[model samples]
Target: MKALAWLALAGLSCMAAADGQTQFAQKANATDVERYEYATNLDIARVIHTENIPDDICEVVPIHIFYEDSHGERHTLEYSVMGGHF
Candidate 1:
């Protein structure tokens, strides 16, 4: 019975760690997308970039990000200049 308790605890810990890792991955993917988008205007002007990608699949996905300026002016920028597929 004691052994089973230990096993259960260990399993729970592992699951928690896995969940944390998954969340971290998603944030990382979003960051990568932002970075790529920012890089587009790195040599031009000031730009802010961001994205929402699931952590589990973020690493396995190749994201195409472009900059979005919310200053009322409407324009579509190509984010593929710094293209990369995670």
Candidate 2:
């Protein structure tokens, strides 16, 4: 019983840490997409998620990247990319 309790506690702690790491700031809005700029200082520690670019189109499209910085703060970056179907 003691072992099981310890396992449960460990599991909960892991879940909480995972949850906290994924909490990205709500900076991107419909009108305010966080576009990337040249020479922008990005302190990315790990990329959490990336929006898939459509392969069938051949034009500029917006892509979103969700990442965590070195300070453990989550951020979203939106940038334009030329589509791959060109």
Candidate 3:
């Protein structure tokens, strides 16, 4: 029916808006980005940074980590914190 079509269209529009908002938030919340040469050891020296987020709030911290392999190929590890239950 026409009513069902309208409902579907409305739902789709809402989803699209939500997606756009989510993308904007991600871009805005990203705090830092960095890259480093591939390290040989898995020790603490490989750590780029350590951030402390407030444990009491329900928030997310977005981090962008990029690196290159020995083969000269670049890679990305997209990491985020959502309420930090991890």
Candidate achieving the largest lDDT: 2
Error of 2 at 78 (Å): 0.6
TM-score, model 3 to reference? 0.26
* Candidate 2, 38-63: lDDT as tens digits: 55566667666555567999998877
Stretches off by above 4 angstroms in model 1 are 1-44, 68-86
lDDT of 1 by residue, 1-58 (tens): 4432332243334342345444443444442433333324322221222233334442
Q: Model 2 has how many clashing residue pairs?
A: 0
**Which run of 10 residues does model 3 get worst, by summed lDDT?**
40-49
- Candidate 3 deviates by what RMSD? 18.8
Score candidate 1 by lDDT: 0.33
- Model 3, residue 41: displacement in angstroms? 15
- Cα-based TM-score, every candidate: 0.22, 0.61, 0.26
Ranked candidates (lDDT, high to low): 2, 3, 1
Angstrom error at residue 22, model 1: 25
